[model samples]
Target: MGNILNSVILESILLDEGETLYKQNEASAYDLADDNGYAYHKVAAWVKGKDGTKYIKTASIASRAQLGKVNVSVTGKGAAGLYEIDSEFYTVGENVPDPESIRNNSYCYSEVNNVLVSNAIYRSGFANLDFRLSTGLPLKQYFNNDGELNEATIQKVKNSLKPLAKTAVSENPPIMREHLIYAESLSAFVDWMVDENGEMVNKVSNGVLVVDVGGGTTDISFINSANEIYMPGSDTVKTGVLDVFKKLKQYLSSAYEIDEEHIRVDMLDKALRTNKFTVRGESKDCEGLCNKAKQHVAKRLNNFIDELVTTTLDHIIFVGGGAEALREQLL
Candidate 1:
């Protein structure tokens, strides 16, 4: 056998046309490497190698299933030729009874390539999220052991509060948290753009902003002049879209005594079909139901926004999946 790698054991075998082999009674033995060894003394069929050599070999042989075609070489031949069978199995290590040996080096090459591709895809997805938050600007990326972002990695987190500054606002701003999943990253992105030296930009200081929505939730941020982010309190609210669907389901069940699962399915289907819930039941029309659901979610969001704006010392920013969807409505 060729010089093998470390403690690795190598095996080689050869079989010819129309040959078969089987294993009989064998005793198993285990080594410190946890690899099992077997002893066999019986054979079931005559076998031959590509070189036309015949041998009984060993009975501790396993079956081989054909995956596809491969090329083989014959002893004392000048050119390689294609072989129909995909794979061959052997019972002995290294030295084979046949003079023409089939090199089985392809297996090692394919396994290593698979691992490289999988790791590349995983890292690419993580980088995409960070780029989206930066609004096209490449930002420093950091990941924890669990692949979550560290709060400190967020740039201009305090500046996200700048949206709370406003004079006409009636309610206090909601308190902002820095560690929410996607929402926080988006907030940091906007804050980095609008806040400069702890002050809101002139345009942002006076105008209301509507954030494009996403899949799970919507984020909203508001800002007005006279309120710098660090000056005082600001409110920020994070609300999930799934919560609205759940509330709507509960309302339909309670008001019309309909089955919750059916209502949920219907509501989802209707929302998908019409992009709005406008179905009517014995108690309410689709429009009313959809509006009620949206409004229910909106009410909570508005309340949070109101608190966040009124209490804060700047502008307001809206973000998240829901906010993105309702941007046109708000505009």
Candidate 2:
């Protein structure tokens, strides 16, 4: 139990709604810049008779750093239909474009757990160590129609993560000893208050609202005095950081005549925060489009908060990857 608690409390992996993976206090996950599905097919067609090694070295299609080790696979479609499948050695990116997509897929689950394992090993100072994972679900999924935690949903999530328990990779592999999950409201509250010494960082016993603005959804929770979490009034917003990326992707695609697949969510996300981004080997200014998207998201989220929260709240704290990005707008 102590080991499990240490793993759960010492580190955390946040699988944000945008399909972005994050490891706490260590390396933040990055996406594969290449579209891999379509872009690879287009690039593979032109490199048919050319030297494969030379093409990978000189091609401006994808940077070596972005794609990592490239793998080319060929498949027969039908009579006289030969198709090439170009992909990275490992998985990256959202694999699908839908903003409402669920994280039930293997790609999403593996990446998230892999980060957890990596962090656990680092914290333990051992190359191979067991870990207990702690994650959270949105408020809507926390309970069933009976107002009880839906065991079925929790078990389904555990089953989905079973494959990542003992992941075997080229580098130091981690063995997941156990896994646990709690309501995200609790997770948010714990993440904010707990410090490195496992002591409460803030003495705010007053009602505080925690707004976790993530990629696809914004989860709001209120922690009141006496360290109690009141979740009946908690809510989730459908629009988040990814919505901004989609809008920016559409704007850039139409403005520059670039393919929609060429724009990645991470790139546009960086641009929104940094005000500069790269597309098709060229750096571009995206401040205007990014600002427009940010302003719109802020307005929509503000409307939700105005309706839900009350004047009794002492502090409204923002957390999560997109929290900082949307902070200025919210304020």
Candidate 3:
């Protein structure tokens, strides 16, 4: 039996509610389910296969158990017997077993014995192929650095994306190179938009400005009427959304003259839930502290935007995690 293992790294924030989220989640989860009928249909479409021939069987297995049961919904002839399966799942957490360790022979045979037994169907003496459609192995495993994804790493990831094929193996060349090119261009555009000095570049011929603000970096780029795009630079700053909480901590410490480490989680939770930073004790600086943090964030965003607009001639388009949150301040 041949088995294919496909994996995708999804951001938690992207899973927020609504139709877009549902569709994305479903698409990602569908790759792990057994779709023998679907595969046969595809074969039938492309070739003159025999009516009863069992050409291919596709199955999707998720690495995370918390995603819940796998629901196989079939239409046409296969719809009558669709069912669910409680498959074995695994994830790499703070202290969890490393996925690369298994493939690299770093893991002891005994350590993965349970995983092997539980996923025997996948481990059986057949072609065991690992598929990363969008990126290479986890970012941490691919890069030796400690920080998040960088421009160079993004480029590497774009280059590593596999093509859409029934089966993929390390030895096989990518089935579609265009997908890689598209992904690379998109990633490059994003990287150019967030780089601190990216605005210095002239412009692309398309005449569209791109701005990207991510957790670890911000990039700005401009495309001119001549269809030439240019990037001045990017900012690799530590001031992300998470920094807001850190700034809140510092603000509380200075205003209340209290040890931030001793602050209760409940208080922090309340602040986040209410969207209002509050202190229990009689501290007149509580409001001021909150304002200061907000001001700092606003200042950084303003500076980045000011530089980006001043250096470019194209209309602005913002994309990224931080950009979404700063929409109010941006206007």
Candidate 3 global Cα RMSD: 15.1
TM-score of 1: 0.34
Regions more than 4 Å wrong, model 3: 1-132, 135-207, 226-228, 233-238, 256-258, 262-273, 277-291, 311-314
Each candidate: what lDDT?
A: 0.32, 0.49, 0.35
Residue 81 in candidate 3 has what lDDT? 13
State how far residue 184 of model 2 sits from its true place (Å). Answer: 3.2
Poorly placed runs, candidate 1 (over 4 Å): 1-238, 254-257, 263-285, 311-317, 324-331
> Which digits, one per residue and each the tens of the lDDT, describe model 2 over residues 23-90?
23333221111111111100111111222221111111211111222222233222111111122222
Ten-residue segment with the worst summed lDDT in candidate 1?
31-40
lDDT of 3 by residue, 122-143 (tens): 3211212232112112222222
Cα-based RMSD of the predictions, in order?
28.1, 14.4, 15.1
Instruction: Tell me which of candidates 2 and 3 scores higher on lDDT.
Output: 2
Best by TM-score: 2
TM-score to true structure, per model: 0.34, 0.60, 0.39
